[model samples]
Target: MIARLGDTEQTLDLPPGYTLVALRELGDAFAHAREIAAEAGAGTLVWVRRYDLVEFAVVLEPDEPLASARRAFFAGMNALADAIAAHCPPEREVAFDWPDAIRFDAGLLGGGRLAWPNDCAEDEVPSWLVFGVILRAAAMAHVPEVQAASGVSLLSEGFEMVETDAIIESFSRHLMTAFDRWKERGFEAIARDYLERLPQRKAGERRGIDVNGDLLVRLAAGNAAPERNSLVDALARASWYDPQARGPKFE
Candidate 1:
């Protein structure tokens, strides 16, 4: 049962269980969601209304400890990629840059971020988790033409007539599907989906996600141990985001 907070002209057709909290164009969906995540509980979605960006955040309550629960970030990334693939133009491709950055045809697109309570310990169950996403829907007039070309947007990538709302709506459904897969299959299933979107750096390199969300990489022919890439460090800052620009980086 998706419910709207107060009557508003803008609405989202989210999945049956989501609760909607719409924000103004200048609102920060991610920040607001984190502030109210405890009382909001799971399935609370906060969306920002903007013409040039697709921004939203969803609240979740994980059953497992914080260490393993961070794997849910992969689930969110998979759903974000899947949602873009659903509306992508033919011949265009969507891929990820390791832990967080998203790319379109090798150009930088926006990415997802995860947040939990400051006091939550690795072995303790977090009271709540928030997964937030921001994608460049259209090129902003304020951005310099040269800089704008360095990054990709839905409109720039030939996604004709794709409304920002459409992407968020699709994401809601895909996220539910992803969580369902986690319930029925396992976290490995979600990890597989995420790895599939990541571009391989070497021909014989194999990649896997660790129990605590670190990326494990190994050469197929080597007897050496797998190299571990820390998820915690990578997620500390979103590679694609430019804080000064307040959006995805242009390079």
Candidate 2:
């Protein structure tokens, strides 16, 4: 069913059990979702209607501790990538840059973000967690030529007439599937799926997600110590996002 909020009309076909909260173009889905996360409960999806970008955040109530629950971020990323891949052209490749950046081929296509209460400790089960994603749906005409050229959008990447609503709907379905897989198989399955999409930085290198969601990388050659990339540290700042532009980084 469609929902109308303010002046925007929602055309999302989300799976059963999702509650829609549509926002106008100027609204911030991430922040809004966080504001209502506790009261809104899980399955609440906040979506911002914008022509040039696909922005949305979903509220989740996890049964696990905050440390491991953060791994839900990877599930969200996998869902986003799966949604994009369903419409992506044959030659285009979708990949993740460590914790939070989504890349289309070699260009940035935006990414995901995770949020929880500031008071929540690693061992504590947070009241709520929000997983948000933003992708450049189309290139803005007024953006500087240099910046436009450096960033990638669905339109620029040869996606034909793909609507913003369609992407969000697709994401909703994929997200449900991701969580289902996690419940049945475990977070390790989700980690494996996410790692498969990540581009290999070097030959003979292996990557895995730790119990606390940190990234573990080691060379296949020997017993050398695996380099640990803390998920908490990596998420502190999104690598693909530009704070000033409030979107994907162009460079």
Candidate 3:
């Protein structure tokens, strides 16, 4: 019923078919999850207990080749955003900034990140992949005023007061649902849902996720060759994370 990693004390009431691995408040859930992903296998959820942030990562074993399996990140993002939206107060908007950062009502609200084996070839089926999430659940004092101006926490954005555990539980269910939809329908449905959540571009431009998960941006409606934004480059480092703070950046 309960699993602990070192000094981590929190307990999470996860949904069926999940394994909760709690980390210390000071632990890095994303990094640690990746370290043990190979042995932990799929459905292992690594979580960190922080008052102002809800951080967690889940290990996944995809049967598809690494090239296409990378698209699982899109499903993770869609599920994460949907989980948060489910708990948010009425009319609160949930959106993404490109491939990784999530925004709420246009305010930076943390986002998702993913990791896979560094040396795996594109065509090889990866042994494991990790999808991590970090969300600002409460206002913090150390967040810079200017950064805070550009970003927001659920508490500051007028969201209903909700428990971090509840969010994680909801996310687990949503993630399973996302994978189900991908299986029952196709990756096209997953791609459409994830792309729809991005900050919509200008009228003439269009956007999409390629088979390999690169973001394709078209500057004009017709006769325009879309520009490719490499997902590998984009995810090399998390855009929404602050290395100094070791958590989600306010901006």
Best by TM-score: 2
Q: Report the lDDT tens digits of candidate 3 across residue range 1-251.
A: 48766654456777778888887778899999999999989999998877888899999999999999999999999999888888888888899887899898888888889999999999999999999988888765587667666668887777655556677888899999999999999999999999788876687677778889998888765776888989988887778888787667864
**What ranges in model 1 sit over 4 Å off?**
1-8
Clashing pairs in 3: none
lDDT of 2 by residue, 1-251 (tens): 56687665667788898999988888899999999999999999999888888899999999999999999999999999999888888877899999899999978899999999999999999999999998988876568887787778888888866555687889999999999999999888999999998888889899999989999999999998999999999898788888766778887
What is the full ranking by TM-score, best candidate first?
2, 1, 3
Residue 73 CA displacement from its true place in model 3, Å: 0.2
User: Distance from true position, residue 169, model 1, in Å?
Assistant: 0.5
When summed lDDT is taken over every stretch of 10 residues in candidate 1, the lowest stretch is 1-10
> For each candidate, how many residue pairs have backbone atoms clashing (under 3 Å)?
1, 0, 0
TM-score of the candidate numbered 3?
0.92
> Candidate 3 lDDT (Cα, whole model)?
0.85
Candidate 3 stretches with Cα past 4 Å from truth are 4-9, 141-150
